[model samples]
Target: MHAFVHEGNELIYKNLNDPVIEKGKVIIALRAAGLNHRDLNIPSRRGENSIPLVLGSDGAGVIEQVGEGVKELTIGDEVIINPGLGWEKNSDAPPKGFEILGMPDNGTFAEKIVIDAKQVEKKPDHLNWDEAGVLALPALTGYRTLFTKAQVKKGDTIFIPGAGSGVATYLIQFAKAAGAKVIVTSRSKEKLGKAKEIGADLAIDTHEDWESLLRNETIDIVIDSVGRATFNRSLSVLKKGGKMITFGSTTDDEITINIRQFFYGQYQLFGSTMGSTEEFKEMLDFISKHQIKPVVDHVFPLNNTQAAFDYLRAGKQFGKVAISINR
Candidate 1:
């Protein structure tokens, strides 16, 4: 099988051995795969050999072979890899030993991959290969961050900082679908317009003082992924006692906050990551029920993966960048 291998600060397409099926695993003939910001960080660890090794965590494919005890799925079934491995159910947090796909284990960058049968869910018929391939990781992250962690409610004024990411884009869609007034921030005016096109109630340019633009309006909920660059301002916009959900820190993770304001104002803070299998199922149902489709900014053929990686690393894409594995 052909795979994009991350070695020495570069991605190389090479012929790698096919994944051997395990007792509870199934071989998937990958049709499509997707990129995340995490992939961008992996290349930086090249000299240290700390890269996820294969570098990918999102994919949609067709089952080509099934292993023992995998009675729920069969060959020829179209499915999406959940990526979040070893965490089966919802809890206060993911249990110890949890891992995501695409590192240590070969991920979807190849034409084939072997994954736990339990982690594969039926792909929605409404989404095409590219859409399905990019759906799982970001959508799950967004869903758990907004609905489970933040507990967003109808008619709530929800503010999401950083509007162009796959997760941030999905947050806007989910919040609006749940009847919340969705506001988003981005430095790119074009991205801000795209956010409004997709249902954001208000879009603000972060290049200016967002507090002034918003008139210091208290937001009911704040879903943030950008860390040090916007964390303080994100908190400042939230209504006192409002919920704030954070999943990623693309900028500096180290942070400082006014302890007195936090205690006296009574803010609810929650940190989230990849979600449970149960939540993945619920996310699928919600998206299908609402007929929501993810925003795919670009799709590149598997062999042209370098260009895709470069595009994502440059932060030029407004939505998910997908790799077309088979077609």
Candidate 2:
């Protein structure tokens, strides 16, 4: 079997023996895999990861075989992995043993992979292979942020910062489908326009006076994935008692919050991570019901994963960057 392996902090293609299916695990013949910002951190794992680590978190494929005690699944099942290992339901935070795929475990950047039977879910009928492969991570993150954490409702005003990334793209569409008024910010005018074309009610240029433009409106919820760069300004855009959910810190992780304003306004601040299996299913069902197709910026072959990671790191992609493993 061939896989993209992390060696000396560099992601390179390698051919290794096929992984054996352990008891209570299943083997998947990957059709497609998707890239995330986490994949960019691979180079930093110099001493942490052992030799030849397979690095990928999201994917969809078909089951080639099932391990012991797996009564529900069978060979030839088309599915997308939950990726999240421990957490199975919605909660205030991930469970004690929570782990995402690709870091500690071998991931989907391979021709074949193995996982616990509990990690797989039947692929949504409405989505194709590439779409299903990318849907689990960003969609789960967006769904948990909007529906579980923020509790977004119809007619609510939702604001998302850094509009061009994979999670932001999914957030824009998900909030819109739920009948929320979506506002996105991007430094690129063209990216802002693309966001608007995809159902964002308002797109603000981050280079300009975006706060001034939103001076009259009170945001119901603000989802900030940009971290330090937007956290302070995001608070200013929210209404009194509004909610703000922070996921990734793509920018600087450390931030200063105005203690007086935060307490006086009764604002709610929360943190979220990749969602549980239950939330993943709910997200999948909602997407299937709404007929929402996740935006794919480009599809690279498995051998071109380095270029895919480069594209993601350069912040050029408007949506998910996927790899066609079977191709």
| Candidate with the greatest lDDT versus the true structure | 2
Q: Write the per-residue lDDT of candidate 1 for residues 200-307, one digit (tens) a residue.
A: 989998877777777656599998889999999998878889998889998999999999999898999999998999999999999999999999999999998889
List the candidates' TM-scores in order. 0.96, 0.97
Local distance difference test, candidate 2: 0.89
- Stretches of candidate 1 off by over 4 Å are 46-52
Q: Write the per-residue lDDT of candidate 2 for residues 1-327, one digit (tens) a residue.
A: 989989774678989899898899999999999999887786585454457889899999999989999987899999999989999877888989998899878899999999999999999988899998888889999999889999999999998889998898889989989999999999998899999988999999886676799998779999999988989988888899999999999999999988998999999998988898889889989998888988888999998898888888888889899999976
Which candidate comes out best when scored by TM-score?
A: 2
Q: Could you tell me which 10 consecutive residues in candidate 1 have the lowest summed lDDT?
A: 45-54
Residue 135 accuracy (lDDT) in model 2: 83
RMSD of each predicted structure: 1.7, 1.3
